[model samples]
Target: MLRSRVAAAGGCVAALGLAAALAAGAPASATDRTDPNDRYTAEEIHHFLEGFYGNHGPRPWEREHLVSDRLKERIAQTPGYDLLLCAQNEPRDIEVGEVTTAQSARVGWATITTHWSQSPRTAAFTAYVDLDGSRPLQLLDVDCAPGD
Candidate 1:
C-alpha cells in the first residue's frame, strides 16, 4: 500500500483542470497510454483506495516506497500528518470515476467525485498511481479541490 506524501517535481496535470500540488517530475509521454486495470485492475484499485480512505483500513505500497529509514519512521509515527491524510479522512464517500494513464504506461490517475453521504454538494479530484510490475501498485498522489 502507498503511504508516502506525494511531492512531484514537474507537477501532475489533471484532465479535470486541477493541477496536482505535487513535486513536478519527469515529463509524461502523451502517446504512451495503458489501461490502469491492466496492472491492478480497476475494481481492485477502487477497492484498495476505498479501503485506505475509510477508517485508515489499509496502507498502499507502504513497504515498497519505504526505502529509507526516515520514511519508515514518518509513516509509523504520523499516518495522518499531511494533506493526503486530510483528504482521506473526509466525511464523504470516495466515488471513483474514470481511470486514465499519465506519465508512464503503468502510471495513471483516477477521477474521483466525492461528497458526504449525507450532503448533496460534490467535489472532484484525481488520484494518481504507479502500477509497474517491478513493484506493488501504489497511490502516487491524491489531489482534491475540497470545495469544488
Candidate 2:
C-alpha cells in the first residue's frame, strides 16, 4: 500500500510532465496515450532520473505542474499509521516513523520507516511520475543510496 501511494504521487508526476513537454514537440498523430498510467513501467522507474544540474537538470517546473499540495496533504492525512499497525503484510516488529511527501511537477518524494524490510536500505524512495499521471515508478539510485 505504501509503495502504491508513493509511486502514484511521485514518479508519475515527473514522467507525466516530461510526456507533456515531449508530446507538444511531437507530431499530432503520435500514438502514445496521454494518460500517465500508460507510461508507467518498472524499467522506466529503475533507470529514469532527473539530474540536479544541467540544461535538463531537475528543475522545479517539471514536477510542480503535475502534483499539488492538496494531494500531498490528503495523503499525509491518511490513516497510514493505523494501516501499518493493522495491516498483516506490514511487519509489526519495528517502530514505524511518520510518513512525509515532497512534490515537484515531475516527481513526488516519500520516506518512511518499516520493519518488514532491511534496516536503512528501504527506508525511503522517490517516485518519478509523469505529468499525465501515467504509470509512475519508484527509482533508487544506482549505488543503492537513498534519493533526495
For lDDT, the strongest prediction is 1
Write one digit per residue (lDDT tens) for candidate 1, span 1-148: 1333242322343522333322454454322332433455555466656654553322455544522344345446555644444344554565666666543466656666666557696666666666553444566665655533
**Superposed Cα deviation of residue 88, candidate 2 (Å):** 33
Off by over 4 Å in 2: 1-39, 46-48, 51-58, 68-124, 128-148
lDDT string, candidate 2, 27-119, tens digits: 532125332443333333323332221122223553343334454444355554322122224442332122222223344322333344445
Clashes of each: 16, 34
Candidate 1's C-alpha runs over 4 A off are: 1-44, 54-82, 85-89, 102-105, 145-148
TM-score of 2: 0.24
> What lDDT score belongs to each candidate, Candidate 1 first?
0.51, 0.36
Q: Candidate 1, overall lDDT?
A: 0.51
